[model samples]
Each structure stands twice: as structure tokens, then as C-alpha cells.
Target chain A: MCHRSRKTSRIRPAAGAETSKTIAKERLKLMIEAEKQKLDDDTLNQIRHEIGSVITKYVDIEPENIEVRVTLKDYKKRA
Target chain B: MGKVITFTSGKGGVGKTTTTANVGAGLSLLDKKVVLVDTDIGLRNLDVIMGLENRILYNLVDVLTGKCRLKQALIRDRRYQNLWIIPSSCSKDTTPVLKEEQMKRLLGDLRKEFDYVLIDSPAGIDYGFSLATSDADLVAVVTTPQVAAIHDADCVLQILKKKKKDIRLIVNNFHRQMVKDGDMLDIPDICELLDAELLGVILEDENIIICQNHGEPVMGKHTVSEECYRNIAGRIAGQEIPIPDYIRRKSIFSRIFFKNTAGKLV
Candidate 1:
């Protein structure tokens, strides 16, 4: 019964550039949250668990670097 | 006033005997007098599958050779009161069920005594297959949806059409996921390939294996496979119950969902 809006803007620089990697990490986190909101809660949970496992198994990033947000909306029962 | 239905598979191990036992049990559940006759001679297995092998002292061979009366040869099914079976002889020295007239006579006698007669035919497109199916008022051609199974089934379909047999298709062991992945053939593809109407579609249910292992018919009250076989029997009995959405896959949403989601999970 509610609406959701999410946005992610990432600014990553090429190697040896002045921009910090922390900025890029923050932007990636924002984009993932936006993508997550577009999916239903169940699908989002599945994707998060699946992606988390794959990333943890293969990616070099620290586990604490990932951040997620989920919002619940108004509830109504159908007749 | 019931029909004689024969279950024939051109390829072996596609559950012809199991289907006969289940559908016969299903029909008997409907209070129809049912008889299941095994025509798979030399390599007999229906009696064993039906759990009546030990009770068979006299067999179809005995009646065919005039050694025993047909009544003495029929074994009552242990589960259903209305169901009976005439098992085949496993002895290698017996005569093959080769003559069409002899089969017609046996079926004629069975037709008089039972409301439904289900014959489990021998495997392959040989004399055993033809003789078992020749007297059927309705023939259910079973296939397993592989290239080899479909090819052999097509050969049998051609032979049955050449003989002007009343035939329909029952696509057995249908794995819907595999079919969606294009790894296995679907029911419509089989029916179109054989140019035959579909009588029923049985999903790949593990309960069939368990039931067969336990020597129990799949037509028990709670089993889904039993319901499918009963629906097939109902269709054969000329009842117009539309094929349920699951079996016929008639719902647009189901078809689109299956088509779209197939093979994506892996």
C-alpha cells in the first residue's frame, strides 16, 4: 500500500586517479539497494543470499562492505 | 458394457504393466468389473508387478492349451474385489500369443465377464505386441518422450494405423522441467509427431516407483498419479471431463510461465 523510491549514483576513477575507492564502493552499494527495491521481498532475499554467497566465495571485497535496506509497506487484506 | 483397453509401449520399461494395474484399479474403484490380462509371454512380469505371481498356478497358456478352464486361470486381485488378472506363462517352452483369432476369443470371453479389460502388452513391435493389442477396443500407446522412445513409438503408431486400430497417446514419465529446457520432448510435440490424439499425460512422479516397488497399484486414494490414470480411464469410458490444467497445460499463464522460466534457474 506504499510507494518506494531509490537512487544510486557512483563515481569511480581510473587507476592512479585522485578519486578514492571508498567513493566507488559507496556508489555500488547505493545501486544494489535500488535494484533490490524493484524486486519483491522474497525475490530480494533470495538474490541477496545468492549474490552474497557468490561474492563471498569469489570476490576480493570484505563482507562488511555490503549494505542493504528493506522497507515494508501498508497491509490490506483482499475480500 | 465397458471397453477393452490395451496398454502398449514400443519401447520397454515405460510402465505399461504398471499403468494397466493402476488404471484397472482406478476403474475398479469406480465399481467397474475390471480384468487385467498379461500378454508378455516368455518374459512375464505383470503378475509379479501386480503381486499375483504366486497365486498363478494356471495361466493364459493353460487355457489356450485347453489344460484348464479360463475361469480357473483368472486370479482375483488381492486389493480390489472387482479386479481380476490372468497372468502369462514365463516358461520358455510355451507357444507365443501369435494368433489374432485366439486373442479375439479370449477378449470376447473377458468382455462378457468384465466391465473393463486392460491388457498389458509385451515390449517392442513384435508378434507379442501385435497379438496383445489386436483385440483392443481402445489402444493407449505409451511413450517416454525421448528420441529413441518416440521413434519406436512412431513405428508402433504406424503399424496400428495400418491395422486400423483405435489408438490414442499417453505420454508417460513426462518431466516438465526437462521438456521446458528443450532437453526432452513435450506432449504436443509427441502427438503431432505421431498424428494421434492425447489420452493422458503422467508427470514424472516418484510415487509410481515406490508404488511399483511395494507391489501396490498407484490408484490409491491420495496418490496424484492414480488420479491421472483414473482421468485417463474416465476419458476412455467416454466421459467428457476436460483434461485438468496440469495435465493438458491449457492455461495461457502456465504455458507462458513455463516457456519463460524454463532452464533459467540452473
Candidate 2:
């Protein structure tokens, strides 16, 4: 019973539907971003400062106005 | 000195021990002297899977505690002459019996004697995982195609990156057909998501479980799983064998006109 039969037929996905693999990848990406946001205050501040510096190089942006949030809702909405 | 490679996964039941056992055996098949150290203390199963359970007179705890010499604790594999295993203690206490410093010293000694020292780490990112990877020259993070496994693997990868350890990813139990059907993540997607070098991928074959149940590795057998293990071991031994192309997602044109023939697109 442990033998995996190679005869299992492949089932094609329905057109225009999101595949399970895509959903899984998106979920994992969100989970990883969420986990990364759990960094300590110092690291988060450093990341914020770095981001502010990078943005300031391109355009005028206040450091205080730059907020980095790893929210699943926003990511899902963007997707 | 031998290279110390620790096989770890942040999640359980993702084939870490199986990869360690078979990769160790595969290294030995390539005429390299390899010793697999089971660091999953108190829950050791590598001995049972390697069919050397009855031969264990001394465990890793005994060696670490100085109850026995290092050589006395190593159980030689029955199949490969150059392969051996150091099983962890199977005590009920889940506390890590081997400290990080002691593990490094033990690995130092192992490095002088073998060509490859493979450590089978326990599940979770706890003390046991730290001890297993404390002195690893390379860490192979094993994960399946499932989202949970991939997420956990990413967490582990982040930790390893913090430690500045050289890391690689091994995808286990990959169903190529499922990937083709868009039901499972493909190889490239996993490599990109994990952001680690692809060590190798093991297809979802029932023979892996069957071989483990038989207390033998599937490395030398003429099976797809065996070839996968061999390629992994070859890569570990610094060979340049390319990963099989069939594991990658086929293009629409190829899928429409061709079929998989013995693990190859035709």
C-alpha cells in the first residue's frame, strides 16, 4: 500500500481560476512578511530609517510619515 | 577535516531524518567515509531507519557525558562499509542532553575521522536545533511543497541567515504531476520563495517510506528516489550533476505535445 502508483492521472485546473500553488505561495509570502514584522523595536526603527533614507533620495518624504506595516489585509487587497 | 552538514526543518514530519540517512548512505556509495549523527535527542529514529538499532551499545549522550569513547558510540552501517551512525539517546526527557559547545567539540572530532558528518536535527527552532546546527559547516533545510512546510522553512532560513550559516534547501515529497496540474508548488517557485540554493528535490515516491520501513536507504536502488538521493549526495560531494529537468514545470507547448517518459519530457 505504500507503493506510490505512477498511474495516477493528472487533473487539469479549470481555466481562469487561481491554482492551489499560487494561493499557497501568496499565503506563504504573507506569512513570511508578517513574521518579519515581529522584529525588535531597534531593528524596525533601523528598517524605517533605511526606507526613509532610500525614499528621500528619490523624492521629498518626511521620516515621521513613513510607516512600514506588514498587514495581510493590505497585501490581499493589492493582490 | 570532514564537512559537517546538519539537516533541519522548522516543522516536523518533513523527511529530515530520511534525507540525512539516505544522503549519508549515498555519500558512502560514492566512496566517501560518512557518519550520520542523530541530534534529535530523546526521539531518535535514524538508528531504526538504518537497521542499526540493535547494534547501538552507546548513544550520543554517553559520548557527550564521557561515559564512552567516541568510536565506541558509532554504529557502523550494515550496507555501506564507510558509513556509520551516532544515534541520539531515546530517553523520555525532551530536554537537550547535548550542549552546543559539546556538540562543536564532538563534530570537531568527527571531522578529523570522516569525510562527511551529517547531523539529523530535531523538529522546531529550539535548543536541540541550535545544538545540531551550532558547528555545522553547511545546513540543509528540508521542506515539503506544502505551504505550512514552506513557511516554517522560511522561518528557519531567516534564523540561519542571522547566524551567517551557509544554507541550502531540499524539497521533499515533491509531486511533479501535482505541480504540473497547478496543485503543488514548482521547483523554481520553492527556490525563489525560500531564497536558498537548491540542494535537490525528492519526488513523492512511496518507495521512500517502503525503504525506510525496511531499514534501508533508497540511494542505491534503481528508483527515481534513489537517483534523487544520489544527485543530492553528488552535489554535497561537490559534483556538478544537474538536477533533473522533469522536476521543473513544463511549458504549455510541451505539455500539449509531450508526456513524461521515465522522468524525462518527451
Candidate 3:
């Protein structure tokens, strides 16, 4: 036989809190992704312009590491 | 058997009533007999949004308590021949059609007359929400991209899962420019967090609010909002509509382009 006794329940953090945190995390991730996309697009466009300028200026010289490095740094600084 | 769909959100003012009204109008345009039941008692707006407020003589409470028959309480849409509504009674008391058994019986009776019964559920997981969903064949969880709304919607989704109900998501009031600018929750992030099948994602439109205030259906060839509603209605009616590439594949094409470039470089 079991004896009857009253037991009080403890309150935990509201369920909505956890869900809210997760939604916040996902939103942050989306913002980061969108920003990264914009940056990448801008970087690509910059690179294209830099490569065109480099080829136009050094048409006589063959493609080499030193020229590309100098051009990339100049483009990065411009950006 | 007729399909009963409930539009619910745990948070308020996320356009549940508006979506219900527009979807009802869209379904009606498709030649289906659609009945929208406003379950938000004490705060009914489906009638006003659908432009049938002045025509109401009987209400949901009257029908539930047997003071009037269902036929008497239903307010037919003047704009659509097959669309109708049972407006909620504005009462201070929280008790509006409280019994689950009563809702089951009422819905069972409603199924005989309409092709689709759309219940605009009250906000939160309370007595009203339970009653509305208990009679639903499908639950359309309406949500916006705002942090609070998404979280509340997720809570509602969890409860619906616990109850073993089939649910589809409708992400409404999304601003595309905000998503593009990294200021708002986009479709992909929302779906990832909720992990539910998204039936539709409606973009934010001022016209929706204007249409509601003017008591008109956002249908026909005039508005983008109407197209979104029509697409949702078509999907509900089992039409295999191609989910627009702008919504589903917004980032996918960019990913592919990056992958191709990376592969070539490596």
C-alpha cells in the first residue's frame, strides 16, 4: 500500500526562453551569412577590376607572383 | 472528408486573421465553398477584414449555446458567392465555446456543408487555441521573422507536436529588403530553426493592411499580396505549384557560383 503525500513542483525557466534564444542565434547566423555574401560579392568585383587593370598596365610582362602580389595588396588597400 | 485548417500563432498581431481572410477569399475564387470561423472571441476582426461586419445578426456564442443555428450565425461574404464566416462574439468573459466536445460536434456538422473550414485561432496555447486546433485536419502555423514572433511560433509548434498534430508553416510579414540587408530573418533561417515544412512565405506589403482596413480581399491581378495568397490557397488545394525561386533558391545560386570558383582555383 502507498501513502498519499502532497509534493510541490519546482518551476523551471519558461519554455519560451529557450526557443527565443535559438531564434536569436539563427537570426544572428542569417545576418552574418548575408553580410559575408555582400562582402564576397564586393571582393569579387574588386578582384576583377584589379586583374583587368594589371593586364592593361603590364601587357608586355608575363603573369608572375611578384606583380600579382603587388596588385592584390594595392587592391586590398583601395578596398 | 472536408479539410479543416486552423491558423494559429502563439504571439498576437502577426496577421493570422488577415491570412485566414485572404486565403478564404482565394479558395472561394477557386470555386470551393470556404467557411472562415473567427475563434478570437472578445476580439473578432475576421468579419471586418472580410468586409461582412455589418451583416452579422447572430454570432459564434449564439450557435455554440444553441440560441441560434449555425446557418443563422454564418455571415456570407458579399464579394464571394461560396465564402462564408461565423464571427466571434465580443465578450469580456474568456469563456467562448470552451468545450472540446462542442467544437468537435460543431466542426463535424460544418464538414458536411463546406469544402474547407478555416479557423482563425486565438493567440497563445490556451483554451481557445486547443479548441480551434482539436477540430483541424491541418494547422497552419503563422509566423513573422521578428525574434519574438518566431520564438512564440516555435513554442506553438512544440505544443502542436506534443499533441500529435500535422502542421505546416506560413511565414508572413517578411520584408525582403531587410532580409537582403541582414536586418531581418529570411526564409532559410526561419525554416532551419522551426524544422517544419513551409507552406508559404508572404512578403511584407502595406497593401495588406490597406486591404484589411478597406474590407477587401487581396485578390485578382492588381496586387503581389494577392498572388501570394492565391499561391498559398492553390498549395492547400493540393496544387503542385513551384515554390518561387526567389524565395527557395535565393542563396543557392550564389553558393553554386562560389563552389564552382573554389573548385577551379583548388
Best by DockQ: 2
- lDDT for each candidate structure: 0.72, 0.79, 0.75
Q: Per-residue CA lDDT of candidate 2, range B111-143, in tens?
A: 999999999999999998999898888999999
Better of 2 and 3 by DockQ: 2
Give me the runs in candidate 2 sitting further than 4 Å from their true place.
A1-79, B247-266
Put down candidate 3 lDDT per residue, B110-192, tens digits, no spaces: 99999999999999898889988997889999999999999999999999999898888888987777877789976767877
Off by over 4 Å in 3: A1-79, B247-266
State residue B136's C-alpha deviation in candidate 3, in Å: 0.7
- Fnat, one value per model: 0.00, 0.00, 0.00
For residues B10-114, could you state the per-residue lDDT of candidate 1 as single tens digits?
999888888888878878888889998988876677776675655777877777767889999989986887999998875545456347887888788888889
Best first by TM-score, ranked: 2, 3, 1
**What's the C-alpha lDDT at position A15 in model 3?**
45
Candidate with top lDDT is 2
- Lowest summed lDDT over 10 consecutive residues: which window, candidate 2 chain B? B257-266
Candidate 1, superposed: residue stretches over 4 Å from native: A1-79, B94-98, B247-266
Q: lDDT value for candidate 2?
A: 0.79
> In DockQ, how does model 2 score against the reference complex?
0.01
Residue A67 alpha-carbon offset, candidate 1, angstroms: 96
Candidate 1 local Cα displacement, residue B101, angstroms: 2.1
